[model samples]
Target: MDIGNRLKTVRQQAQLSQRELAKRSGVTNGFISQVEKNQVSPSIGSLKKLLDGLPMSLAEFFADAAESSSPVVYRLDDQPELGSADISYRLIGSHFPGRAISLLRETMAPGADTGPDLLSHAGQECGVVIQGRLRLTVGEQEFELGPGDGYYFDSTQAHRFVSIGEQELVLISANSPPTF
Candidate 1:
């Protein structure tokens, strides 16, 4: 998928110039231009910052901002990916009307992480490490968890996830209020 095109369309729809978006998102205008041109790929956290500047949720940004029917049951292929080159976030029911939760099956490459910026959002987040190792940082506390481990916490607190060890990290996570 061309995430750069998606981002460009969204930014234009929001009536934001690259300079304005950069100012709002704390990124350089050059960076924004590079991303829009696909000359550079923003990390998940970087993209999140840009979306936050647009006052949009990652789910909303990726959902194409359309009103669509919500399926009662989602097939495996029904999930939409809201991820970057280094990570995979397969979001289920992304277009579900009245969605109150964000469910994602995530996979991170070895040494891949959510980027330098900490992620903060509304509601709560919980997840379980299904494969490999996970390094979860919430507030100033950090924990190294392995398969079968799970966590729950308020989403307002700053947090980020890192893939530890030499293998890919896979997890299933959910955020209330659909923060994505």
Candidate 2:
């Protein structure tokens, strides 16, 4: 697979410019340019950073590159978008039958907030902030996190995410019913 081409396609489809993605991904624009041109191969860590801008994962990216149809991989590029007014999430593995869990790649625009509400449900949720900063409100507590910060909590707690900085926020999350 041409990783550079795939990267470029996903970035454009996400409506991101190379500079914008670099800013969100915490990499230099020069580095993004080089990656897109296939002039440099990104380490897994570095590639994960780049994938943040597209709100994707290394598993999802590589899954799409595989040629087999058995076991059915849900390509990141083909994931369906799900969102309310302020926050948007891409649902991963939406088409799978009897999906006991779900994964999502989320993006929140600056100044956007997902309203605070207690969610009473089964299962657990864990997320890693991939870009910008996020203010998470759970029950009576609130916390702020920058890129690479991670959180895991019970789904029964009321929680919401707010973008706290000028840049957009990105997160990779997994939950049951799967969090679409």
Candidate 3:
């Protein structure tokens, strides 16, 4: 998705200028320009702050970009792919309007990791391992979870996940306040 273009469109739809948004969001206009130009990828916190200026929630922003008609059921191949080369994240109910939760089927290749930097944001996350092993790190604690193991934690805390076993890791995970 072109987040920059989407943000620009949303801002224009709201009839707000870059300067105005920056003032309301308490960020520099340069930052807003960079984001809108796709020169930078804003952090989750930064994105939230930017959205706050428009008085829009993350869910609303995504919902607006989603398909107009939401379906009750999605076949296996119907789900949207949202991950990178090392990971396979297929979003469930991706077309659902005003979705409050993001349910995903996540597959991590062996030795795959979220990134070097920890992830922190609002809301909460939960996941259940369906296959292989995963190394989960939340804050300063870390644990190795096998099949059937589950985890739930506040998203505000820094967290990361890594596939530790030789085999790929497959899991079902959900995040409230949907971070696509």
Top-scoring candidate (lDDT) = 3
**Tens digit of lDDT per residue, candidate 1, span 1-180?**
677877887888688999999999999999989999999999999999999899899898777544333467878799888898989999988877556799999999999999899999989999999999999999999999999999999999999999999989999999998876
**Which pairs of residues collide in model 3?**
none
- Give candidate 3's error at residue 148 in angstroms: 0.3
Per-residue lDDT tens digits for candidate 2, residues 1-180, read 677877786787678999999999999989988988999988989999999877999997777546322246667777887887768888877765335688888999999887645455667888999999999877789899999999988878888778998999999889865655
Model 2 misses residue 55 by how many Å?
Answer: 38
Alpha-carbon TM-score of each model against the true structure:
0.60, 0.56, 0.62
Clashing pairs in 1: none
TM-score (C-alpha) between model 1 and the true structure: 0.60
Rank by lDDT (best first)? 3, 1, 2
Candidate whose TM-score is highest: 3
User: Which regions in candidate 2 have their CA more than 4 angstroms from the true location?
Assistant: 1-72, 116-118
Compared to the true structure, candidate 3 yields what TM-score? 0.62
Model 1 misplacement above 4 A: 1-69
Assess the local accuracy of residue 123 in candidate 1 as a C-alpha lDDT between 0 and 100.
93
Worst 10 residues of 3 by lDDT: 62-71
For model 3, how does the per-residue alpha-carbon lDDT over 1-180 read when each residue is reduced to its tens digit? 667877897898788999999999999989999999999999889989999999999887777766534578899888999998999999998867547799999999999999999999999999999999999999999999999999999999999999997999999999999998
